[model samples]
Target: MSKTCLIVDDSSVIRKVSRHILESLGFEVTDAENGQEGLEKCDENMTDLILLDWNMPVMNGIEFIKALRARSDGSSPKVVFCTTENDVEHIREAMSAGADEYVMKPFDHETLQIKLKLIGFD
Candidate 1:
């Protein structure tokens, strides 16, 4: 079976781009526009991985990560912060929040593929 991935982002463009990339790489992808909706989706489906955006409305990535981390063992998805926030502090904060990986925005297909592979998603 193809691995399932949930993409949480407010931008339609980012969702479209990520969907295309993940599909091309053989993943089954689902999407949510914000953190709350992402949480709802999580409750409804089992996601193998999550690609989360940091600056979304109605619950930013940090809050979302915290909430996910607060869940019981079988409830949380493996998450990677895929965001525009590139500062060292931001990366550290995401790591501290339990993100398995972090990838900066404006990434090309190759970079994304490599990062995913490095994280054992490929």
Candidate 2:
């Protein structure tokens, strides 16, 4: 069966691009505009992967991941922070918050494929 992926980013362009890439890789994709809405989507269905963004309104990626990790099945979904935050500290923070991987913004199909493979999703 195809795996499920959730793209949680505030930008509609990012969500649309991510959805296309993930679907091309054989994943069933969904999206939300912010962290709170992303959590709502998770509550409705079991998501296998989450492409999360760092900065957003109404709950950032770090806060969202922390809250998610507090849930019963929070660890079930592998989270990958897809954002413009490329500093070492940011990467470390994401890892500390239960992110399985980190991908910089404006990722292409091949790049995303490699990252997903590293996380055992590709």
Candidate 3:
């Protein structure tokens, strides 16, 4: 089966950009505008990976990761925080919260593809 991915970001442009990129890499994509919607979607579908954005209107990426890690399943989506948060502290916190990977924003298509491949998702 084709791997599925969830793109969670508040910006429509970001979501669309990520969806197009993942689709080109043969991933089936689902999307949500914020962490609340993302969590709901996760419950509805077990995604192979999640491309999450920090600083959203509803719940943020960090909050999402915390809740996801609290689940009884003991495993959540292989999440990659795809955001503009370049601060070391934020990155460290995301890592501590159980994100599988973190990618800073302003990423090119090649960089995104490389990260996905490194995670064995591409």
- Evaluated with TM-score, which candidate comes out highest? 2
Q: Name the top lDDT candidate.
A: 2
lDDT (CA) for every model shown?
Answer: 0.88, 0.95, 0.87
Q: Write the per-residue lDDT of candidate 2 for residues 14-58, one digit (tens) a residue.
A: 999999999999999999999999999999996999999999999
Candidate 3 clashing pairs, residues 3+ apart or interchain:
none
Model 3 scores worst on lDDT over the 10 consecutive residues at 68-77
lDDT at residue 8 of model 2 (Cα atoms): 94
Please give me the total number of clashing residue pairs in predicted model 1.
Answer: 0
Q: Report the CA-based lDDT of candidate 3 relative to the real structure.
A: 0.87
lDDT of 2: 0.95
Show model 1 residue runs off by greater than 4 Å.
74-76
Q: What is the C-alpha RMSD of each candidate to the true structure, in Å?
A: 1.3, 0.6, 1.2
lDDT tens digits by residue: candidate 3, 1-122: 99899999999999988898889889899999999999898888869889989899979999998988888752746889987879999989998988888888877788888888787775
Candidate 1, residues 50-120, lDDT tens digits: the string is 99999999999999889888888433467889988889999999989989888889777888888888778
TM-score, cand. 3 vs. native: 0.94
Worst 10 residues of 1 by lDDT: 71-80
Error of 1 at 31 (Å): 0.2
Sort by lDDT, best first.
Answer: 2, 1, 3
